[model samples]
Every structure is written in C-alpha cells, then in structure tokens.
Target chain A: MEVEETRLPGIGLRHDLVTASGRRIGVVSQSTGARHVVLYDEVDPDAAAATVELTAEEADAVAELLGAPRITERLSRLREQVSGLATEGVPILPGSPYVGATLGDTALRTRTGASVVAVLRAGEAIASPRPDFRFQAGDRLIVVGTADGVARVRDLLRSP
Target chain B: MSDAARLLVELGAVVLGLGVLGRFAGRVGLSPVPLYLLAGLAFGTGGLVPLDAPEEFIEAGADVGVVLLLLVLGLEYTAGELVTNLRRQAPVGVLDLLLNGLPGAAFALLLGWGPTAAVAMFGVTAISSSGIVSKVLTDLGRLGNRETPAVLGVLVLEDLAMAGYLPVLTALVAASGGASAAASIAVALGVLALVLVVALRHGHVLDRAIGTGSDEVLLLSVLGLALLVAGGAEAVHVSAAVGAFLLGIALSGELVERLRPLLGPLRDLFAAVFFVFAGLSIDPNDLPAVLLPALGLAAVGVLTKVATGWVAGRRAGVGPAGRLRAGAALVPRGEFSLIIAGLVGGAVVPEFGATVAAYVLVLAVFGPLAPRLADPLARRLAVRAAERTAQQRAAP
Candidate 1:
C-alpha cells in the first residue's frame, strides 16, 4: 500500500504503486484536471503497456463508485463500537432547503453538530465530498453523530 | 496594387507557406522549427524568391513572436515549481551550465569572436529545447517513466537560468562600452529581482485583476498586458522577451489554464514567424562557411547535453538505463538558442547568425533521434542489471 509520488513539474503529479499481484499502476493527474490510469509493461517496467485517459467528471464518477461502500462500512463499524453514536441516511426531498445548493451552503455540521460522511445520489454514493459538492433533489445524505445530532440534521434538511 | 492589399497578399502567402511546412514537419515526425527556418531563408535576401513587401510586418510579427514565446514558456511552470526544482537541482543545473555552455564559449573564442560573442554562444549551446524535449517525452509515452521528473527538473532549472542569462546577454549586446554594459546588467538584474518579488508575493492580486469567465476579455487583457509590459521593459533597456516572461510568472491559478488554449494558436503563429525570421536574417551563403564550425559545435553540444542529463538523472536516483534516457531526452536545442541568435544578430561577429542557425538546424533535426538511438544501449544496461540481481540472489 505504499505509493510513490513524483512531481512532473509543468505537467502535474503522478502516483505509482505496486499491487500484491505485482502489477505496477500509475495515475497521472494533470494540472488541467485530466487523469490517466497507466499500467506498466512487465517486460520493460518503464514503458506503459496501456494508458486509459479519463476526464475530470469521469474520474469523479469512478472514485464515487469505488469509494461509497468502504466509507459506509467503516461508519457502520464505528456505530457498533460506540454506545450513543448513530449513522443515519437522510433523504433530500424535492423541497429540502439545501436542494440545489452546495454542501457548504447548508452549514449542516455547524447547525446540527452532525457530520456528513457521504452523499447518495441516484443509487451512487459519493464519499467524503468537499464543501463545493452540490446537493440535488432526491439525494440521500449520510449523517453521523449522536442520535440527537442526527435528528437535528434531518430536521435541518427538511426545514424551508 | 494598393499598399495594404500588397502587404496582405505577401503576409498571407508567407503564413500559408508556413502552414504547409508545419504539416510536412508533423508528417515526418520532426520539429517545424528547422523547416520554418528553411522557409525564411528561401524567401529572405539572396534567396530564390526574395520577399520585400511584408518585411516590416514580418519584423514586427517576429518581435511579437519572441515575446509570446517567452510568455508561454513562463506560463508553463508556476513560481513554486521553479523554486522547488531550483532548490533540488541547483547542482545539476550548475553542472549543465558549465558542461554545455563552455564548449560553445570555447568554440567562439577559437573562432576569434570577442567576449560578447562567447557569452552569446554559451547560451546558444547550454539550454536544451524544453518544448521539443517535453513533446518527445509525451509522444514516446515516457512521461510516466521513473527518470522523467529528473529530466523535467533539469529543463525547469535551465529555463530559470535563462531568466537571468537573457538580461545579461541583452545588456552586453546593447551597451557599447564595458562600463555601460556593467551598468545595464546591474539595472536589468535589479528589474528582474523586482519582477520576481512581484510575481511571488502579489501574484494573487494579478490573478484577481485578470480573472474572468469570458474568454475574449481574458485573452485580450493578457495579450495586451504582455505587449505593454514588454514595451516597458524595452524602454528600460531590459529585453522585452524577459518582460513578457515576468508577466507570465506573475500569473497563476486556474486562470492560466483558461488562458493557455486561447494564447496557444496566437503564440504558435508568432513563434513560427520568429523562427522564419531567424532564418531570414541569415544569408544562406554565409551558412556554407560556418557549416563546418556549426557541425563541430553540434557534436560538442550533443555530448554536453547528454552529460548534463546523466548527472541530473543520477542525482534523482535514476538507474543507469534511465539516466541514458534522460540524457538522450535533453539533446535537442531549439527556440532559446535561436532567440540568442536573434539577439546577437551577427552584431558581435559577422558569421554569428549563420553559425547559430546552422548549429540549431543540425541539433534540432538530429537531437530528437538521440533517444531512439539510445534504446539499444539502454536495453543492454537493463539486461546487465537484471543478471547482476539474479547473481546476488544466488549468492545469498
């Protein structure tokens, strides 16, 4: 699980890692938000056997697909370990006050003392979204905190 | 024909000719610089069909080309990257300067050019073409290689050095007396430092000033600012190209990314003109006399450039094979050398332009081939390393 990070100067950054199966993978992230998943050739090691380019949005979608389950699983384990801690999935109805607004605009954590762990939109989970992440109608937010804090978050989302 | 119509026809034809040459270069997997230079020579004085109508326009376009070239070059890296790479690769950078620069200086001295021409030649040979090198790395899919960062570090350091070197060269070229040259150098260096501080500390203010969603507004402001600053720098006797470069450094963030595509085509057009103008300035007849000297210089330039990369790659902990790749990647010398030639303009030595033009033509054409040639040697080194590793395992 050790990744070597190399700065490409003008280009961007590249993170290279070797999997347990001995496959060398490199992800090149350009300054302009272009990404390339590079698989190295076993024979040459320095040469890329295959490189798949991804746009910024496609990269985010791929990350969301891979990230959702693991984050929720970790949260569920934390819930089991704590006595009063709760993790709840709160749905954003069509008329929620935060709908179509950024995650930061809601000020949900400051208002309710609950943290948003992830967002579930159209059955896809986006984990650990930044403040800039926008909320949409029909999106479900995963809130984690004390039971009271979680209840407050639910109420806050429903409030006009 | 009316004067305006004549200018339009000649300028249009020259640009169209350049476009055809560029396409040809692309098809043949070569840089268009040499081809553009050849085109310039073809239409220049004493050539097959000498052009007179658009001479003034070409001259002006060439000036803009140099500015835009430096500006775009400065935009390639942020100030942070420049500082970091310089910190890490300062030794390699110094080594690069000595190894690559001295040969050209020595060659110039041997040719009996004065100290000024020697200084000019030092730059012509020292700096590798970052544009060609990067494009080669990308085209070869070597951007993901272990040795690439080291290669890029060397290029960045060379570019930063140019920020300082260009002013010195420009001052020396402009000043008639040694004392005046010294004064000009001091003033240029002072202005350069001022620009650096502004670029580093108040870059955000500049970013704020020019940050706009509208492409047209952003493009016009950046270009106009670049030209204005370039003109101002020229007024102070600092090179206008350096002024454009300083403007580029003072800009950062996502706005630079937005400005790139808009500036790219414009830069390309002007840059092409600059290269052709470099060729146009030279007499092809003078090239024959300097060809021998240029070849000798080219031989020295290739070895020195590779040596530079070898040292840099080793410092970065790259393996022997990867070091060769790094060195090979650095062999091409292009626009910067021509910029030096353009500055020198045969003012120091009558044959300076032809010598540099011939030298660049040789290297730019053959430098890209260095990496391909190094592959076999690199493969052998890799095999030896694998064999040694296997032997070590058996010994244990």
Candidate 2:
C-alpha cells in the first residue's frame, strides 16, 4: 500500500510511511538531506515512529540551511581534529605584548611551536582565524601542537 | 508658572546653552562634557544666573544618571565573553589595579584624608576609562582587531572590581559612627542576589507581559523596574548604580535587545537633565580657586591611567604601536569617576566632591580629544619602530 507523504514545518523533511495498528512502518525520508533522523519506539502504544535517513551531501546541505545541533557537533569534531595537531589554549593579557599583534606578524607558529586554531572574543566563537587577525588585550587563543610549543607561545605573550 | 515649572524652564534654557557651547567646542575638537559643566557653572551662585536649589536634589538627579550609565554598561555583559577576557587579561589587570591603587591611596592619605576615605578615592582613580577607551578603539577601526579584545578585557575586570569596591566603601562609610558594617554589607549583598535571581528567572516573562501592552505601559514598566531596583539598593545600604547594573546584567541579551530602543529616549531625556543639573551645581566664582588644582589633578589622573593602561597592554602581548594606542585611548575620565566621587565625598566633604566634580568635567571636555591624538600617535610610533628595525637589519 502506498503511504501519504507529510512535510514537517520549518524542518524541510518529507516522510512516507505505512500505519499498521497505530505503528508507522516502512518509513522513507526525503529532503535536501543534511539532517539526522532518529526513530523512537513508544512502549505504551507499542508503535514505531518513522525512520529517518539522509545522504552525507544532503546532511551538509541541510546543516547549511538549518543551523542545528548536528551542525555544531560536526564543527566541534572538525575543530577537535585540528587542535589535536596543535598545542593547547594560550592565555593573553592586556599590555603583556601579544594584545595587538597578529598571528603572521608575531610568527606565532614558528616562534612558539604551537599553531593558533581559534580565538574566542566577547562571547563569540571565531574559528580558524586568519594570519592577519590581530590579537586583542583580552583574547583567549586555542593553540594546538606539542606541550613545549604551547608553553613557548604563553611565554612570548606574557613577556614584559 | 509654579516654582517647579519655572525651574524646569530655566533648566531647559541652561541645557540649550550648554548644547550650543558643546557644539562650538566640538567644532574646535574639544569634548562637550566639560563645556556643559562650564555652562552649569555660569548658571550657579557665582555666575550671572543663580538657580539656588539644594545640593542634595541636584546630586540625586546626577546619581540617577550614573546609575543609568552603569545600567547601559551592564547590558554589554556576556558570560562567555567575560570568561575569555578574564582568562586573557586577569593577570595584567590585577597588576595594574594593585600598582595604581596603592599609590593612589597613599597619595590621598598624604593629602590628609583618613585611611578609609583614601582607599575609596584610590578605587575611583585606579579604574581606567571604559567608555573613553572603548570609543577610541572602535573609532580607530581597531575594535575588530586582536588588541581590542585585551583592552576590553582589562576594562571589564576593572568594572567588576569597581562593582565590589563600591559596596565595600559604602559599608565602611555607613559604619563610621559604630554601625554594623558587616550586617549592612550582608543585607546589601542578599538583596542584590535576590534581585538578580528574580530578574534573570522572570525577566523574559516580564518583558513579554509588559511588551504586549501599549508603549506607555512598556515604558512605565521599564522605568519602574530601574527605579525600583535602584531604590531597593539604597534601602539596603548599597549604592543605587550597583542595583541598576545588576538589573541590567540580568535583563541583558535578548531582553535588552527589545527594551533598549524603547528605553533610549527616556535615558537620554533623564541624562540630559542630569548633566544640566550637574552643571547648575557648579559655582562659577569657585572656578578660579579650583581651576589650577583641578586641571593639575586631571592631568595626573589622565596620564597615570594612560601609562598604566599602556604598560598593561604591552604585557598582554600587544605590539608597541598597539600599546601606545591603548594608552592614549584610556585618557578620558567620564561619568563613573564623577559618580563615585560625588557619592563618597558629597556627604563628608562637599568641597572635595566639588573638586572631583570639577576634575571630571575637565576630563570630559578632554575626552573626545584622546581619539584624535591616539590614531596619529599610534601611526607615528609604528613608523618609527619599523624604521628602527630596518636600520638595525641594514647595519647587520
């Protein structure tokens, strides 16, 4: 039996399924699929919800269109991978020497041993900052690499 | 017209005059706040026009203005941003606070004030210019740059310290005649915590409820909340600005985003009256006696803050050029210093209060000039440093 397709509002998802004794069976998901779909079973009613599936390309496209938890999760994973190749985070202070200098000008990677991957400023997430991004007096930098590299950057920034 | 109406009209005239003078001063590249104070002086006892009202009334109004200013400042607070800044600038901010505050307290003591008074005075001066520094950095298009964050970080820490300092000072002052300082402080803190929790937990609901009403109702509610919190703080032996700032912090973000535009005109209207009242309290004849000392103190205050800021900025890993820029950017002492001085000194030594007020007025007049000076100074320093580096390379 052919089942009717229903689109969820604002979610850009259409699902086709069969209702058998209050259970959704043989569910098919369709959309510009970047979203992850979860199936839940209700014990009280003994019914199964529609199954959701998306292609990898569709997942990315959906993420771009809808900024959801899944997209954030993916970004976090990517950041973690990059950070694994670098050092830990470095603390910056006002007037300590690193406040106004940029990554390229300071030659942070070459001089310090760690590469700066992200800068968090004023509650905003700045990911993968460019070499030209200047350091502010109160910026916290996430650096990745060897432990010594991280210490080196910290020392340079803190140097009087 | 009744006395109040007549007074209001006179106040309007004074504001208009100050506005004109401020505009003229702006044309000449001077800060307008100073000019407003001067205009106020002209309308006081020593000048041609005398609007003799009690000092307390004028002070009360100015106090409201200060609270409003802090309210705006608190609106800028973001938890995540503050944490990041603290991690970066805490070490340097602490050092600067210690270095500047110690010396300032000693200076005040040497000038014959008691230990408590001296300490309070030190707090007033140790904190750098938040509004001035932020404005200058933004104007130079450096706010988005890395150095801006550190400078902002230091200011944020200073503001937080000031928050704690004001209450401590108030408690000390209140306890002077053998009152219970600890109890007073505890009550104040308790009330503050309660207010914050309520604001945070129910602010959105309150906003929605009030927002759905007419504009007048929304305005009234906003004003009512501000006044209530401010009044509550005073009732609990705390400074009103502290209450307002706390309220602001709780109601900030999305709630503030919706309420600020509605509240803007009211703040401006009250703020305008506030400055005019501040000016009217200034006696013109006293200016001659206070002018030299006030200017001297103003210079000291500005120079000390700038030097301290630059030193702190450099230690934070800001480049030499950026450090100099940050230093110059911090030169203006505006509303906050004036409010603290007024609150602490007004009741104890009116003369000292007047002196500090005069100092602030002069600084405000000089405030706008800092940005003009900072950009050129930063550029020149950058060039000089670059040339020196090039020369060293060539010689090698």
User: Top model by TM-score, which number?
Assistant: 1
Model 2, runs deviating above 4 Å: A1-160, B1-5, B52-60, B139-141, B189-216, B374-377, B387-396
Error of 2 at B166 (Å): 1.4
TM-scores for all candidates: the values are 0.90, 0.64
Residue B56 CA error for candidate 1 (Å)? 1.4
Model 2 chain B weakest 10-residue run by lDDT? B138-147
Candidate 1, residues A1-160: lDDT per residue as tens digits? 9999999988999999999997888988988788988898664565566888899999988876777668768878899999899899999898776778998998888888899989888767787879999999999899998899999988877878
Show model 1 residue runs off by greater than 4 Å: A74-107, A119-124, A128-141, A145-160
Q: What is the C-alpha lDDT profile of model 2 across B345-375, one tens digit per residue?
A: 5555455556656767777767656656765
* Candidate number with greatest lDDT: 1
> How well docked is model 1, in DockQ terms?
0.50
